[model samples]
Target: MGNEQSKEKEKHVFSTHELVFNQLNEAPVYCFDQNVSSEGLAFSHSNLKVRFPSRQDQFQVAYLNAYLQLGHVDQTLSVRARLEDSVGSIAVIGFGESNTRSHSDLYLFDVTQRKVYLCGDEVPNVRLPVCGDGDIIQFQVDIGRGRLSYQIINSASSKQESATAGDRSLVTFKFDSADLPHSVRPLFGMRSTSVTEPSFHVLEVSRELSLTDKALFDKESIYGPVTLSNDCLNISRQDIKSNCCALIDKVLREGTHRWKIRILKDVGASTCLGIAKHPFYVPNMYGMSSQHMYLHSQLMVWRSYGGSLYSSGSKLSHELRPLDYDDKPVTVEFLLDLTAGTLEIIREGVSLGIAFKGIKPPVQPVVVFYAGCEKEVQLVSFHSNAPSGNNDDPILLKQSGSKRSSDRVTKKHKKRISYAFDRSMTYGSLLISPDGMTVERRQSHIGNAYCLINQTCSTGVYNWSFKINEDQGASICLGITTEPVEVTNDAIYESKSMYLYRSYMGKLYYNGRELRKEFEEFWMPGTIVELILDLVNGVLQILVNGINQGVCFGNLEAKAYRPIVCFYAAMPKSITLLKFEHFPSEPKAMFVPNNLNQGMPFQSNGLSEDIEKGIQRTDRCMVCSAIDGNVVILPCKHAVYCAAHAVVGEYCIVCERRIESIVNVF
Candidate 1:
């Protein structure tokens, strides 16, 4: 039985070796190595293994039955080795079957780095009482993606008191094939004191590395060419031309370029001049400057130097003066070269003078008339120079002359505007005339006293109603009526006062108390009361039946408020307010305390002499009045017109031709 058992163990060990070798062959070339030996058996390119001591006393072994060594035939890479097993197997190995042994662990090795990653030296041995089986164990290793992994697992429970004995069922390990040495070997196996053998199956699979795939991928490999179409090119051209001039100016001002200028043409002429300047320094000389000027025509060149003083001013100060000289219009050309610090200007096939020496190369050349005295000017033509290499091809101006007709301009300024206040007209109706004058000649009306009652009640409950006049005054009449007494009561109450109150801007106004209260339900028969509200100038003027009562002055600050006049009626009859009037006072000038004539117009000494002589003979002339030599004028335009004979349209006042519009000048 012993010999039979030994033969069976040998067969199991040989099968394990075959399984490992076959597994290695099936996997990628970097899976295992064939140059590691243990005891009498050599573990070359193989899977992981675990072993135990044999019970046979005669056979004292130096190595265990289960062991493994792996290598990569195709690459020099590091491989991790480990063990794995089922959960039941782990429980059996962790806790002994009868609490005889402790737990089990795993061992790891990196063949490429040639170092032991983890040394699972001590493992517990255990046995399962129910199954009556000892712990089972195995190992695994994987190599891929420049990394390695390894693990170990015990499948059974074995109650073994030995320190290095446990039921380890399974193990796993992995590594990167790229980390392995191309012709290297792996060393891994078990050690024991007796001849014992364990069994294991090998696994091998190919793993594609994400890193390698990423390194080899290319986006352009899938898509083709990227080029703009003709339409796109045209669009780009339009955009460039529209913004290019301004962009060029900005670049020349802020960029390394030293100077820039815009030359506009004089009216009705085609010739233009553009000048630019650049500054440089010489080692031995003072700083020097260069000016590049463009003359759109030979006529312009002649006119510029001809000493004709058509316009006075230096080129820097004068604006673009019109050139009325007879000459063919010429387009301008521009050229700039930073390397040589030179700008070439050509117009109508003519080259302007090269300005190589100047005080500060004209950043912007002072424009001068083409044929007039060389005075500074501002306007220059856009066609002063065409872009280089493009001949005569007029760079169409992006912004043409205004399209609005001259007639329209004249018509817009000639119309008369008006404002109407009729209800048929829309609210806020303001019509502008072509002449730009505003005419507001219409008036809004406030009807009967009953209307006043409605207006007042609505104002108290809702919003107040008032007529706003353009002359800076408003009429507010409250809608309220008074009740009248009978004939018998009228005798005893000769006068009965009924008060009508209205509020404006935090203040209240009592228009008047009327004696007649006859028209309480309809239009009140009492006198109509109205107030001229001048909130702007802060004054309230009261009026009873269109008669001015008095004016009150105070601070009346409200967003929307007007002076309101109320009336009370003692008889039942319609009290009609003929018209709502708002007469705002005009501003007057006062003397400057010490000087009476400070704001008055000056008069000649001759006039003063004549006036003095005339004043002596005019005590009855009725056309002169002088107090402290300051004269007063009447409506007849008569200066110092006496009170008695200040006749209208009969005398001259300050040389006034018969008074058409009587204007009082103070």
Candidate 2:
């Protein structure tokens, strides 16, 4: 029982930590997107919310990255985000690491495709949960071990798969970082473009190493029947300390490899570990005379080992060494500098002061050999740097030569988008509904038409309203598309998604690029037009006052689209969004580790059945969790309620004062 308890205590536990984001105390630890001004943006190392007044220029991007250079990368790094934005605006939040956009190292979590991407390319036939409206996304990058993972951290939606769940990750991706060490600039950015000044706040950057990252010897990687997880190496049947042999497990390359080998069982005469450029004991392995380069071989002499020259069909004269070492494992480091063509041997973290120059290109077949056929010579940790490089480390990430962290993180309250009619998705008489769940346009006679935002629903059936209150000279085109267009003439303009317009001349558009056909569907007062768009099967149809208009557009390439309503200054036009199934719901990516020192868990994915039922029954404000849940914060478009409780202290309470305006829903 005591042994069992000890074994249980030795097992490594998994826990998350708080992230170090762009902080306020020090200089901005990251570089912001230059295309967008950082004026009204509120950012910290743990949280960030970007917003501003309606100026002439807003950052015309769906999402921007705050590129941070973590000078030296570790085994694993984690980042969490709580995305709050409109539909189709941000498909997914991307974590990229490269010098530039083109021909660079990029990792993207494609929300629409439900696939993770490396370098803008797809990750084959893998499918993961897509971030839905008001969802938290956790992003993790394990560079040394080569892993990237994400998890949806909210419990409100059908796709909520937070760390509190059994999986601990939504979707984990793998990539090779060994080849691209130079491309190590990780950036936090977004997908698509956001016309509105979207606000993002809850975030963190943290790291931790798993148990497998220890520097102890790996028995399986080494050849021969070795002991179970032991550092000692037995070269023969018995432990005779002379002429016994072994090789290091790490495979080093000529130019890009460095290793540190310790002399464990070094015998005085024949037990020594040294550099060799060919397979040990292989006859003519390199097809060269002296195993490609000079080493202590049976045919070569040992006295003159430094200073190079001379080649021939005849055997080349060479040298070797009775290497200097003691019974205590004397550490020796081998550095092969390919550019300068020199091999320097370092002893116990100190340079041995001996360098072999004139070592030119194509430095292949790198190996370290030990000769002790009768004796025993062991190689220990040639692939490591320090003598005992981080042994049995606890649950914490080793930072860059500084503060070690062991604090536990419990996520507090993270804001969820109050899904409703977006005020920013309107103009003139067109705007968000009073209830904040639909888009509405009041009656007007000017030749002005309001268009739904190009970003809304990228995939799935999109159902929208096309009502006509008092249609006087109304030229309204109601269809599903992702184009930002308004009808000035009696026709709909070409675009990327799809559209249908009804004026004196009714015209149907395919992909904003093709104008298919024309019909004479004139607008009438009290006419209820319902546009049903099936984006998945590539079919679009319309219902005129509960009457079906067959299939207007078919076989379309897959893409998310918003409902568009164009008005050419038509008078008396009042249209309200009756309802939307899954159309107008935005897709946000948010992630936050549980911070005990803060408030409640941010996404709260692991609530009890009763708690979940209570949450479902609750209709309170997102910030205060009170009952006034009915208002939309402007510029950001996140709805809220609780009038007196609305304004919390100096910060906007909900969005942390990242907005400039707040309007009642009703």
Top model by TM-score, which number?
2
Scanning candidate 2 in windows of ten residues, the lowest lDDT window is 589-598
In candidate 1, position 354 carries an lDDT of: 39
Q: In model 2, which runs have C-alpha deviations exceeding 4 angstroms? A: 1-47, 51-74, 156-169, 179-181, 185-195, 209-397, 400-666
Worst 10 residues of 1 by lDDT: 280-289
Candidate 1 structure lDDT = 0.24
Alpha carbon lDDT of each predicted model:
0.24, 0.42
Q: Count the backbone clashes (under 3 Å) in each candidate.
A: 125, 50
User: In model 2, what lDDT does residue 586 have?
Assistant: 18
Residue-wise C-alpha lDDT for candidate 1, range 1-666, written one tens digit per residue:
999966764442322223322222112222222212223432333323433233322211112222221221112122222222211221111100111122122233321122234223322232211211232222233333233332232223342223242222222333333333222223333332234342222322222211110011011110001111211110011100000000111112121122222222232222233332211000000010111112111101112222111111123322222334334333344444333544455544455533232222213222222221112122122222323432111111111121112112223222211211122221121221111111122233222121122111111111112222232122122322233311122211122222233321212222233211111111222233444344333323333322222232222232343222232232211122223222222211110011111123424233433232322111112121222222333333233333443445543322333433222222
